[model samples]
Target: MPLRALFGLLLCAGCAPLSAQDATRAPEPNTRVPAGVVRYAPSVFPDRIVLSPAQDAAHGFAVAWRTDATVAAPVLEIVTAGDSPDMGTPRQVRASSRELRTENGIARHHRADVDGLLADTLYAWRVQGGGTWSAWHHARTAPAPGAPLALLYFGDTQNKNVSLTTRVVREAMRHAPDARLALFAGDLVSGGDGEDDNEWGEWFEANESLPTSMAVAPAPGNHEYFEEFEDTPRERRVLGAHWPLQFALPGNGAPGAERTSYWFDYQDVRVAVIDGTSALDLGTAQAQARWLDGVLAASPHRWNIVVTHQPFYSPRAGRDNALLRKHLLPVIRRHAVDLVLQGHDHVYGRRLPGEAPTPVFVVSVAGAKQYRLSEQAQRTMRPVAEDTQLFQVVRIDGAHLRYEARTATGRLYDAFELRDDGSAKSLVDLPEGRIDERRCERAKTLKGRADRCWE
Candidate 1:
């Protein structure tokens, strides 16, 4: 029987047709919302405002937001910062808009790229949806070349409890108020596919305290891709519909992997965001590997970091991204990448100064979801944490890079520093009091594992 005919027959018999892809599509048991609940609201005014780094941060930045269909034309108002408190005349730019039909309702997503701004200067901008306009938000352009820089990093926040993630982000912001950029290591939502408007809304709501002025750099995780249909035989998984519409990321990446897998330079650091889902599932790993090497080789920035969903060195025993490690690890080692930030494993683990002078690999979680530390992780990964929500603040000043990881309640968990002395670099682990390690009680079923608590 033909595949289509077989699928039709299965439908008639009330049996679901499974395909090769369907076998691999992991179900997201973490999502707690009921089916058909529309969470995304397209208000008359713009909301979910987000700022992303431009290809050139020194002079450009991108903003994206959502509004109701009633607001046909989307516009942005930008102006140079003035000494006076009063608002000044602004330059208006017409933004391109698109309509997205979610489970709840249709929403108009708008994005604008503003350029020709002064370097190392502060600017204020706002968006308009119909007659309503957003409040003024301020952002600073990238500082002069080789200037000091700081950034906030978060791991997987995919959880039924977004407030936990929200608290972590808020606490991190309080600690690093001057951070120029915020990087999410992926799995930003509990929904594997980005189709859950409510989950997306929860994520945005959690980050309400984060200023729209700061640039956000996000990587895609497995949860961001969902199987289009379960009844069909050809179970194709694709990127979430909201992934691209919500983020106006840099586009300087490989041909097939444009916005999702791209690289950008900010001051003295070069950051690369790679799509691990595409690499592992869509056969784009080779392309990403080649692009990574080219980007690392061409970059002139003193510090190089790569962000992806899966770690090059898997922290969990059974969970392993062997292909990613095989394809990208060599390039990362050869180029001496400074740091690799990753998420997916719902635990915190890092391998600093591995074997030789290799890049520091880190996997962390910022959400309430907790997983058991693998036996391998327990033996190898130093200061591993389970059932703990945490965030990291990294500061780079010339030759020195300092990283601090703190729990959601603002307790220091782990700290480290990497110093580059022109010829060689050294990793110095800073002393910090961390909570006790969490483990799982001997259990047989999924429910038992889920019910496991902190030790």
Candidate 2:
């Protein structure tokens, strides 16, 4: 393949335009696609079924789905998958439904919260919507307290979710089949308003069956918030209605930010999901900061991790999250967070803790969107990549945590280990058989456009 075409496929920088904040859409004009080519519409049957972790993943969990507005009464049936030939009797739970109007059409979102489940047990579930039953899917609860756990992390599957990003997610799953939870570091879709049903549909389709088996904890990004009105002189953006409607999240977040900002404990890990978009743009930064400090202060888990959309240290050139750095960074550093997983830079960067009680900060992207690395990133980040699609797998045991990053083709790109010494955590780089940092050569000028490289 030609360099530009290869770059187009590897880094989906060609799909949709970057976020609304970017001055230019796709820098390259030839990568644009027609609207009619992308088709991901809603249907009468239940689709886009996703599983989210409850506050206590071992004892409770939730599942959310979508269907036509006509499905008045949606139901979910779950049964324990035991060693016997026949599956055990199923328990039926009535799901709460809400009607939402979108660009595609009108659809109803149904969410069912299940509690009192046995810890570390596998359960088979199916949902009834549009008078049809979905295929039986399997999900496992978190292991017993202090038990070993594996987690899957992704940066931004924002652009070309179905066409290009699906392989990265699937390959990650194949690499860690036993992962219990997955964390999406915001920008799950490219739609700025976040109400585009086609984009949501494509994101759901891209994940395939991963959400069904492993619990997901997603943080909202700037792209998830859309302006309330396009013609209004003033800009007033609100959280997309589809965001809260599609995924059933824990309501244990701070006031004014319930589902978007919350925390959940899985096994020996406490994952704090923050609403960076709301905090930076919507005047809830201080509230979320207070809430985060409280959450981190009271955490009893062996390992504490924070996941958000914006990064304290951005990897892109001439980009920085001032508000996030001002409000959230101190709280994160004060609490001595173990890991900070962030996105929105469309590049890979990792910073290890030094003499200060700082956490291991990592910014990664799982989609095709690519960006130029900042000069600061070049000097600060030890191992970084550009124009590369990556996924992360983390395993946390009693006192040891293993982290690994791999490309879309399943090549180990970065690895590290952290061991807790009861007083503080120590990091050790695990760089064996890892590939060299990937970068593109600079080109003076392109035909008519100012300097641009082939990703």
Candidate 3:
């Protein structure tokens, strides 16, 4: 297929406008129908079954979901089995509901918090919505600081996002099944009906199998915002109801973020997630910034990695990530961050630890969407994928962390290893393959609208 069509195809494919629903009624976009495909609704849609972990990670995890109409209180429960098939059915715990009202309409958000969980242990859980419970999801508590850990990171899958992004993630999982954490550098979804409930469902469904295995650490991207919602940008759009509830994160709230923003110590890793979208565009930047410094300063983990949506520097050459540089750079450099992960440019860019205050900043993209790399990114650039669909598997062992970029079809595009010998150091590079040897690298512009492709 032509590159232009490919670009459009890869960009995010989500809930289209709610086909002129009644202006005076309906809690959500009144769907002529719910679930499955239709000739009229030619595009694929998602179901509202997002299961995440919330609350104190050591003792409790929460589950959340949305329904067309008000649903009865759900029963959140769990069970135990050390990877045994006979782990018996998970038991039920607690359930509650929150009314989510939007211009589109209002719907009930169900939440179930499973309490009395074992520290640093694995268990299975599910929730009962209308008498039927969700499938058993397995998870473990966050490791206290000083524990060894691993996580997966992906860039923006916002525009032209397709099933290819799905395979990239699935392939990454196949590469590292034991990864305890999943890190998204933002741009989870594209900029459009940012308030659409099932839009997030598509994102969650993509990672459902993995959530059953580990907790996810998320950062909001600009696209996560909704300018059409009101005069102001509707960043995050209550994604928390799903984020906090499904991930069952730590309540050690970030210095200023309270529950909406927090930090948690997982093993020897103190993963500090910052909501750049909320802080920068939605009116919480200063507070979150102050808390970020405190979290980094207090982080006693052997490896310190900050995950956010926007990058302090863009390897996209002519591109600039000035806003974040002014806001977050100093803090990161001062604390000596090992790696920075971000997505927005719809391409892959990595920076070395030299001139930059931090060791390395890597930009990655998951999903089928592709972009041409900047010319500046070619020579000065270390590794860049201007127009490729990719994802990364990050494995952390002892004082060492390794990352590999693989194609959605599961080809090892590039691999790098880092050893912490007092400081971050890179070993020999992995063998260069066909991907690394291609000229389809950088182009003047991406396929669709230049603004959409670049953004």
For candidate 2, the TM-score is 0.89
Ranked candidates (TM-score, high to low): 2, 1, 3
Q: Estimate, for each residue in 1-455, the C-alpha lDDT of model 1 and write its tens digit.
A: 44643553443343233344543445444444556655566888889899988878998898999998887778899898887867588998888888888865889899899988888888988999867999889999998667888899999887754546678888988999999999999988857454478788878888884749589999988887787775698777788788888888887877567757988888888999988888877888889999999999988987999999988777765788888988888888999998899998878888746576559889998886776677788777877887688899999999999988888988888888889899889888887575565443322112323223221
lDDT of 2 by residue, 1-455 (tens): 34543444344333322222332334432213345543444566889899999999999899999888889778999999766657978999999999988776788899999999999999989998776899988898998778889899999988778777899999999999989899999988877533377778878888998888889889998878887776787878788777998788998997677769999889898889999888878888889999999999988888899999898888887777899888888999898898999999988999745786349999999986677677799888879887789999999989999999999999999999889889877888989989999864322112212122322
TM-score of each: 0.88, 0.89, 0.76
Q: Top model by TM-score, which number? A: 2
- The prediction achieving the highest lDDT against the true structure is 2
| Candidate 3 structure lDDT | 0.60
Query: Clash number for every model?
Result: 1, 1, 33
- Candidate achieving higher lDDT, 2 or 3: 2
Q: State each model's CA lDDT, in order.
A: 0.80, 0.83, 0.60
Q: Which ten residues in a row have the lowest lDDT in candidate 2?
A: 442-451
lDDT of 3 by residue, 252-282 (tens): 5554355556666566666677776666555
| lDDT, candidate 1, at 79 | 90
